[model samples]
Target: MQVVIEKRGASLKVKDGQLIIKHGDQVQALAFNTIDSIVLSKATVLTAEVVAQAVEHQIDLLFVARGGKPFARLWSPYFGSIATIRRHQLLFSRSPEAVAWMKNVLTRKMENQQALLYALAMPNHATDKIIESAVLKIEEDKQRLQQIEGAKLADLSPRLRAVEGQATRRYFQAVNIHLPEMYRFGQRSRRPALDMTNAMLNYAYGMLYGRMESALIKAGLDPMIGFMHREEYNRPVLTYDCIELFRTWADWVVFDLCRQQVIFREFFEVEAGGYWLAHPAKRILIQHLTDFFEDQIEWEGLTRSRYTHMSLFAQRLAALLKEYKTDKNKK
Candidate 1:
C-alpha cells in the first residue's frame, strides 16, 4: 500500500518500529512492512528517522510539488542489482533493437487508444463514424511504424513522432466528441493546460511519470537512458518513452470523471498561468487511479493488477537489456 501525506503541516515519523503520521488532531500508525511507498507534497514535513526507516524497509519516498509533479525521490540503493544492467542500458539505448522496442511501445499505445475509442462508441452514427475513422488512421500509423526502416533510433525518431502525433490528434478529436463542452479542448495541452480535461490529464500524467520512474529504478534499469525520447540533461527520458504504453490508463480515468460531471467549480483554480487541480480534486483523482491500478485484469493469459503489469514489464525490459551484447565489429 502507498501512503500519501498532502495535508498542510502534516508530519511523518517513526515510532516503536511503526510509521506514525500526524496532521492536525488526527494521528495514524502503520507497520513498515505494510507500506510499499510514501508520497508527500511540499506542504508536508518528515523527520530524518522517517527517511532512514523508509530506506531501511526498501520503501520509496516520493516528494512532489503542489502541481503533482515529482521533483525528488528517495529509495534504497540496494533496491536492485546495478552495474551490469546499467552498463547494458547505455548500449541498448543506441541499438537497432531499441528502435524496434520503441515501435512496439508506440504500437501498443495506439492500440489502447483505438480500444478506448471503440469502447466509448455510442449508437449515434456521426460519433461512431468519427471513432471509426480515427481507429483506421491509428491502424495505418501502426502499420507505418512496423514498416519503418532505421539503423538506429535517431534515424526513425522524427518519422515515428510525426506518425504518432497525427494518430493521437485523430484519437483526441474522437474523444472530444464524447466529452461535455466544458471539459473538452481543441488539443492536448501541457505545462499549463488550457482546459479542464487537459489540466486533469497533465496532473495524471505527472503521477504516472513518477510511478514509471520508480518501476524503472527498482527493475535495475537506468531511467535516464532512452530509445525514442532524446537525451537531455537531468531527464529521465526512458520513463518518457515507456510511459506512452500506459498513458491511456490515465486518459480513461480522467475521461470517466469528466463524463460523470462530478467536478465542482472549487475543485480547480484558474490563474493567469492555467488551470490547477485543487486539493480536493487531487485527492479524488489519486483515489480513483489507486483503485484502478490495484484492480486485477487479464493480459497474455495471466491475471494481475495494472501496477504489477508495469513492474513486470520493467523487470522484463531490464532482463532483456542485461542479455544484450554490443557488436564491436559493426564499425
Candidate 2:
C-alpha cells in the first residue's frame, strides 16, 4: 500500500517509527514497513524527518503536478541492485544493441495500438469508423519503421520518432471520438491540459509513470540513463523510453472508461488549467486501473497479470543489456 497525502497544509514526519500525518484537525499514523511509497499531492508540506525515514525504510517519495502528472521523486542514494548494471546501462545507451532493442519496443507499441483499434471495431454494436482508420494509419507507420535500417542511435532516433508521431496523432483522433462531447479534447494537450480528456489522460499517465519508476528501481536499473531519448537534467529518461512500450495499455484503460460510461462530464470541474477530476472521480479511475492491472493477459505463451508482466519485462530488459555488454567485452 502507498501513503498519499493530498490535503493542503498537511504536515508529514516520522514519529516513533510511524508516518505521522497532521492536516487541519485530523491526524493519522501509518507503519513504515507496510508502506511501499509516499505520494504527496499538490500543496502538501513534508518535513525533513519524513525524508530521513523514507531513505531508511527504502521508500520512494513522489511529488506530482497539481492534477497528478509526474513531476519529481526522491529516494535512497544507495540502490538495491549492483553497480555493474548501471555501468552497463551507460555503455548500452549508444550501442547497436540499443537500436535493436528499440526495434522490438516500437514494433510492440504499434502492434498493440492496431490491435486495440481492431478489437474495438469488430462488434456490430462497437463498430467505430474512426478506430478502423486509425488502425490503418498505425499499420502504415509500422511499415515505415521496418524500412528504417541504421543501427546507430544518431541515425535511427529521429526516423523512429517521426513515424511514431504520425501514428500517435491518428490514435488520439480515434480515441477522441469515443469520449462524450463534453469530455472530448480533440487533440492531446499537456503541461496544463486544454480540455477534460487531456487532463484525465495526463493524470492516468502520471499514475503509470509512478509505477514504471518503481519497477525500474526494483529491477536494479538506473532510470535516468536511456537510449532513443536524450538525457535531460533530472528527467527519468529511461522511464520515458520504457513507457512507450506500455503506453497502449494506459490508453486502453482511459478509453475503456469512457466506453463503459464510467467517466461522465459531471465528474470534472473547470479550473484555471482547463479541467480536472473531482476528488472522488479521480479515486474511482485509480481503483478501476488497480483492477485492470491485476487482470490476466496472455504474454510470451503464458497468462499473467499486467502488473507482473511489467516487472518481468524490466528484468528481461536488464538481462538483455547484460548480454550485450558481455558480447561487447569479448569482441
- Best-matching candidate per lDDT: 1
Tens digits of per-residue lDDT for model 1 on 19-77?
99998899999999998889898888889999999998999999987667789999998
The lDDT of model 2 is 0.78
For candidate 1, the lDDT comes to 0.87
Point out the worst 10-residue segment of candidate 2 by lDDT. 118-127
TM-score of model 2 (CA atoms):
0.86
- How big is the RMSD of model 2? 2.9
Q: lDDT by residue for model 2 over 1-331, one digit each (tens)?
A: 5666656688897788899899888989999888767888878888898898888888889887767766788888764477777888888887777887887798888888888777666455454767877888788898888888876765788888899888888877776766666667768888777776677778888887887877788788888887887546678878888988888787778877777777766777776757777776687777777688778999887799886788788888877666555454876
Residue 250 in candidate 2, Cα distance off native in Å = 1.9
Query: Top TM-score: which candidate number?
Result: 1
The parts of candidate 2 lying over 4 Å away from their true place are: 11-29, 47-49, 231-234, 262-273, 294-298, 301-305, 326-328
lDDT of 1 at 165: 93
